[model samples]
Target chain A: METVILMLGWVGVFAPVALGVIGSTIGCSRAGMSACGAMLDTESGYGKFVGISAMPSTQAVLGIVVMFTLNREINTLNAPGIFGVGILTGIALMLSAIHQGNSVASAINASKNKPEIFGLSIAPAAIVEGFAVFVFVFALVVSGAIPQ
Target chain B: MNSDQYITLMSALPSLGKTYHVDIPPISRFQLEKRLNLLTEEHQALLSDIESVLHWDHLNSHYDDSELIQSATLVLEQLTHKHYDTLREMILWRLNLRTILAGLRYRQRGDELNHQQSHWGVGDMEAHIETYWQHPYFNLQSRFHWIASVQESLQKNDTMQVERILFDVTWQYLQRCSSQHYFDFTAVVTYVLRWNLVSRWSSYDADKGVEHFQSLMAFALGEYQQLSMGIVVDQNGDSK
Candidate 1:
């Protein structure tokens, strides 16, 4: 029972990093594909696409920070709480990153054709990022309630 | 060609078409020359090909109405052919429909369908149009029911009614395609088609132009709905 609890606790601590990285990897690749396509269409706006493609990478960094914060002494009493918080938060970050990446890809595609809409087009991606931030902040807040 | 990039290119087409729209009546030779100059070098080359065939300078000076109409018809045929080679399948269908209509009209008037000048530059359709008209294999009959309807108009000898029916059929086809593939390149192609129709109708009747523009807005709404749904599927039907 002790070994099982410790294993669950460890899974909790590392879950955010693993899931976040997976999400970011997929997200960045999706956005990067669009950026590459945008570069082919226009001559001067390559920088914007490259920059937008990096948006999804933020979730991975957020995940890393959450994992570090969740790291603490593991026991049967708090293992379930830690596992629940960490796994759920990781899932949220992962899904948000994936969706945000899609939004950024669309922005890059739209702006490449009409450069005048570059700033406005980023609104959708930024809004998606806002949701990720909410999840990140809420996870940090809720993780504090779990007993060490 | 990612699906997103195709959609982006398509979304830009309406603005591009708007740039080509002219509001003035009886466009002057000077205005036409100026417009040609405004286009990119590639577009200018394409337009020059038509001008060379028409000898526009001589035609403009002579002001022969029948000759001008003939030249315009030839120019449309040439451009239609060129666009078929460059544009997507959806747009090629629209071009084919226009050619089919022109062929029907020519047949009704007992004009020589085999003449090179009368051809719309569609693949084998220019040569085998009569066979296709009579037999219409390969689902062409269902795809283009307008052919038979136009034949009825031909019997009545109502050229205006035939044109109206063709325009309606083309508009409905565009609307259907746009709604069915709202997230794909079809939506953008629909916009360009709508703009082209609006410009054509407006040149003839301002009320018709306004009506088509309203329909274009409806199609644009469908595009907006697809975007809001966030169903990002590529050309291969892979979702992100």
Candidate 2:
């Protein structure tokens, strides 16, 4: 039972980074493909499309930070807390990144034609990112309460 | 269904604005065909099936009503088997339009309603249309108000007005569907359909213009020849 708990602790510690990376990869690829497509239609503003494609990468960075914060000596006492917080945070981050990527892709598509609305188009993506930040910050706060 | 497979393709397609508002499609036929090459082989086949059923040229008038219904039924079955809900809905919409319009034309010509002729339409509304054949708008004015105007225009023998109303209604319907879908197969389909709308409209205009110009030229030339003949006849009379 002790060994199982410790193993779970390690899995939890790594889960955020692994899941976050996977999510970011999917999100970035979706948005990047859309950006590449939009580039074919427009004459200028290629830079902005490329920039929008990178929006999903922030979740990966946040995941790395959460992993480091949770990386302490794992024991039976802290295992459950770490497991719960890490897994939940990872799921939230992953979902948010995926949906944010969809928003970014839509933004890029819309703005490619009507350049005047570029800023407004990205607002939805920014809102999705905000949800991810909420999960990241709360996960860190909860991790501090776990037993050393 | 996951639309991720088509994100790039859908995004790459240029927006086709409102049919009446646009003078020409933003992309040329050659450019559009080139972009369509990005679709997968399976998707290409599916799209070809869709076009074969709905495209103006493919729906030849010479094909009797029964033949069109057979082909449309087969295509609808294929779309259903593939689980293409949007495409199926679009095709059904078109079939409904054809049924309603055919009913109107038949009624306009004072033909008796023939319920036995099931080949007139391919969908569930055939019975309803036959039942309401004597109604001015086939009793569809409550649901499709535009049918009333179309019927009125047809009665007046204003073919151009009827065409305009049909184009506008079709354009708006496709536009509404397009807005609900993005980065998906439905979006691509709607875009292509709208492109066809624009191309057809422009060509129709051009053809009408050429027809008018030819008629005007014929009248003017006829008047000139008549005057010339009269002048020669008068001159010969004076000489004699």
Candidate 3:
């Protein structure tokens, strides 16, 4: 049933959001004491990058919430590419979260070399997060204002 | 004329302004000269009053002269110049000693660490520290370049990072102390601020913890000043 497909898409989106949060949390912990002070040393050198890497996690949480509410309406819709978007977007949202965690880890590593320029390391990692933010925005468009 | 004016005119003595000083002396010429004269009279009066108390050595005294120390023993010898050079030279000399000693201590610890068990090895550690500390004699840009490099490397997930910053600084002459000072101040501030913003430091709400952040920034400024070369900020935040 179309309803089953939408429910399935919603489940897929939720899974990646959880995974991304888990990944970032793990990466942040491994990032040691960085930016927060005392917990990480300038000696460790990865604190600033870790600080930036840690921000994208909010996007993952945002994706899960949006996709869950839209799933029921998605089943009712019969528009072009609507169902396909639900499926593809669900997948992209999850991967986007994962991509963010990887990028966060990369940014944290960059902080190790340049501790003072934490902002620079954070900017690139934000690009990876752009994908998730973009996917979320696209899902809203595809859902056609949720017909509410 | 006021001592401030006299000091200013003396300071701007046509040939003296050739020095690459980044700032105009704080006092106006009228005020400078007045202050200088007042200081001279005070010097004479103090000496006349201290004929009985003049046995202590300024350089070897128990007191620390962190504030405005310039030696003037030669001038102090000139009944008019008594002890001015002693103070002038003392300030100049102590600053050099502090810079050198700090550099040396950093170098010695670095040598010991490399010879011990560092993954960076001795030569690389030596090279890295040499590079970090070989900083420009007088530009904040070059210094920021060094700071940015350290920040960038950490973001990229480079390994054995602590050693890299240490070595980078070590290469320059170990002038900056490598002992982690953030921990000393941040712990106290974080606890007092109550906002963790992160998983570990997540206990305090941001609104409740802003004071802590301010304190942390303040502390970092102190650390940065001590580590940088040739940049001097006085108590009132005037940079020289």
Candidate 4:
């Protein structure tokens, strides 16, 4: 049982980065495909489209930070707290990243046609990024409370 | 189809403004065809099947009502068997609208509802239409308010008005479907359909028509000059 808990603690410590990487991979590809396609239709503004496609990559960075914060000596006492916070934060980050990718793709598509709305169109993606940040901050705060 | 593939394919297409509002299509036919080449073979086949039933040119041929219904039924069955629920639904709705318009036309011509006509309608409302053939709007006006307007336009003998109303309704329906489907195969299909609508309306522009006519005339004159020169050369060759 102790071995199982320790294994889980290691898994939890790694989960945020793993899941966040997966999410970021999918999200970036999704938005990147859109950006590449939009480039075909437009004469200029290629830089902004490329920039939007990179928006989902932030989640991966946040996940890496969370993983580092959660990295410490594993034990039965700390395992459960780390496992719970780590896994939940990972899931939240993953979902937010994926959805943010979709939002970014939509924003790129819209603003490509109506250049005037370029700033406003990215608001949804920013909102999604905010949610991911919330998960990152709370996970950090909560991981500190885990028995060391 | 890969979701990313669809996102890319659709993003590459420029937005088609409101149907009938644009003086010309945002994208030319050549560019549209180039972009459509991005679709996978399977999706391309699926799009062709869907267009057969919904595109005006395909159905505007000299086919009778029964043949048209049969073709639509076969296509609908194929779409259903392939689990293309959205496409099947859109085609079904379009067929129903066609049936309503045909029924309205027949009634206007003073032709009594023929009992033997099983091929008249093609959707859930077909039975309702048969039962309510004597009623203007086929008793389905409450469900489809636009039917009344279509009937009124028909009465006025305003073909353009009828086409305009039908185009608007179809555009709105496509827009609704598009909302539910973003960055997917369905969205791509809806965009093509909307583009067709805009193209059709743009074709009605009198100025464009005159320009097209002038271009045709110039081409014809050029061809005639070439033919005359060829004939003169042939005569000279014979004399030699």
**Number of the predicted model whose lDDT against the real structure is largest:** 4
Q: Write the per-residue lDDT of candidate 4 for residues A1-148, one digit (tens) a residue.
A: 8999999999899889989998999899989989998999999999999998999999999999999999999999999888898898888889988999999999999999999999999999999999999999999999988988
Q: What would the per-residue lDDT of candidate 2 be over residues B51-115, giving only the tens digit for each residue?
A: 76777565433468677778788988988998878878987887788778877888889887776
Per-residue lDDT of candidate 3, residues A25-73 (tens digit): 5434432323332122234433444356456566557656655645453
Which ranges of candidate 4 are over 4 A from the true structure? Answer: B59-64, B205-240
Compute each candidate's TM-score over C-alphas. Answer: 0.49, 0.89, 0.30, 0.87
Ranked by TM-score, the better of candidates 2 and 4 is: 2
Note the Cα lDDT for every prediction shown: 0.65, 0.84, 0.40, 0.86
Clashing pairs in model 2, backbone N/Cα/C closer than 3 A: none
Error of 4 at B88 (Å): 2.5
Local distance difference test, candidate 4: 0.86
For model 3 the local lDDT of residue B197 reads: 12
Collision count for each candidate, in order = 0, 0, 91, 0
Q: Model 1 reaches what TM-score against the true structure?
A: 0.49
**Cα lDDT tens digits for candidate 1, B180-226:** 65334334435545555555655686687689667766666777757
The lDDT, on a scale of 0 to 1, for candidate 2 is 0.84
Q: C-alpha displacement of B112 in model 2, angstroms?
A: 2.3
lDDT of 1 by residue, A5-121 (tens): 879888888888889998898788778877775664456867778998999998899999999889999888878888888888789889988888778877876777678999999
| Residue A5 lDDT, candidate 1, scale 0-100 | 80
DockQ of 2: 0.61
Error of 3 at B92 (Å): 57
